[model samples]
Target: MNAPARLRMSRTALLPVLILVFCVVPLALASAWTLVLLLIPVAVAAWVLRVGVDIGDDGITARSLAGSRTVSWTELAGIRIDERNALWLVTTAGTEVRLPVVRTRDLPRLAALSGGRVDVPAPPAQ
Candidate 1:
């Protein structure tokens, strides 16, 4: 099988994250307590910048701040887009696996990677 296609958050999305990190730098330097609080934005940045999804012939691998999980194509019940335009994977066990950093525009490539197991939603009418 071909190598998995990896998807990540857009670079434009990292601008706000970088700004927040810089804004928190002084606070983090001020005191131990503030330094402790700095972990929040750090984690958010890690999630935004490092999180990714890999789609291959065998399965889908989702990586987040927590960890990575791979679900085989056979295990997937279906796929759908939420109101927020996030793509979700529905497993046969009925669990909903949210694909982080996955936007509506990424669906076509994801569908191709899934070997057509996922149907790309039609664009909305004007």
Candidate 2:
């Protein structure tokens, strides 16, 4: 069977989950203030996870928690893994679109599709 389209996790999803676990957990047990803080991270996580990137035969589709975008293959520039380890889709114009999520196990698949390069551009000199 032909494999399914690729979907990457949202890097935007991580910060909040980690924050909630580390910063909010203890505060949750002690005070209402902390409980209120919980809403922020939870909301962020929900929004980020809800968003996703779909790579299919037609092209790549990026659906954010708030909206969705579709770009044809012709517009695809490349892909890259950031220093933070998030996968980003680079457009021909050089804009970096963050993928929904990234997993180590998925690297091989992504690399294959990206032609062995993740499109990670070199950092500009200071």
Candidate 3:
């Protein structure tokens, strides 16, 4: 079996920092309201970071506490890099799925692995 290519969860870097700055720092500064108000962003960040991705010879897989999905390299048509710098895998069905944080920088790498190109498409008109 081909060895699995491990990718660390993206939230591992950002969540702690946000928690420290917004939650811990505010509490340290003795601001109750700040801590309370920051909770929303903190929760959202936590939720966002919880998603992770892994790649290997079989293809690419995204795992989260919520669920897991494996996408074959062939099934992945291409990648779209958003203005926000988010990388999404384009499926043959024309649906776009956001890659996990760990796979953010992995776009170019994935493109290289799939022998494809990385192109950021223009956003649709508002």
Top candidate, metric lDDT = 1
Model 2, range 1-126, lDDT digits (tens) per residue? 234365746475587588666877777769766577667677777766666666666666777878867766777787666777776777898887777655545666655664443443456899
The pairs that clash in candidate 2 are 8-101, 9-100, 9-101, 10-100, 10-101, 79-118, 80-118
lDDT of each: 0.84, 0.66, 0.64
The clash count for each model shown is 0, 7, 0
Model 3 segments more than 4 A misplaced? 10-50, 102-105, 111-126
TM-scores of the candidates in the order shown: 0.79, 0.51, 0.54
- As a TM-score, model 2 comes out at 0.51
Ranking by TM-score: 1, 3, 2
TM-score winner between candidates 1 and 2? 1
Determine which window of 10 residues in candidate 1 has minimal summed lDDT. Answer: 36-45
Ranking by lDDT: 1, 2, 3
* Model 1: per-residue Cα lDDT over 1-126, one tens digit each: 699888988768778877888888998999877887688777877777779898888799888888888889899988878999888889999898889888888877888777888887676899
Per-residue lDDT, model 3, residue 52, is: 66
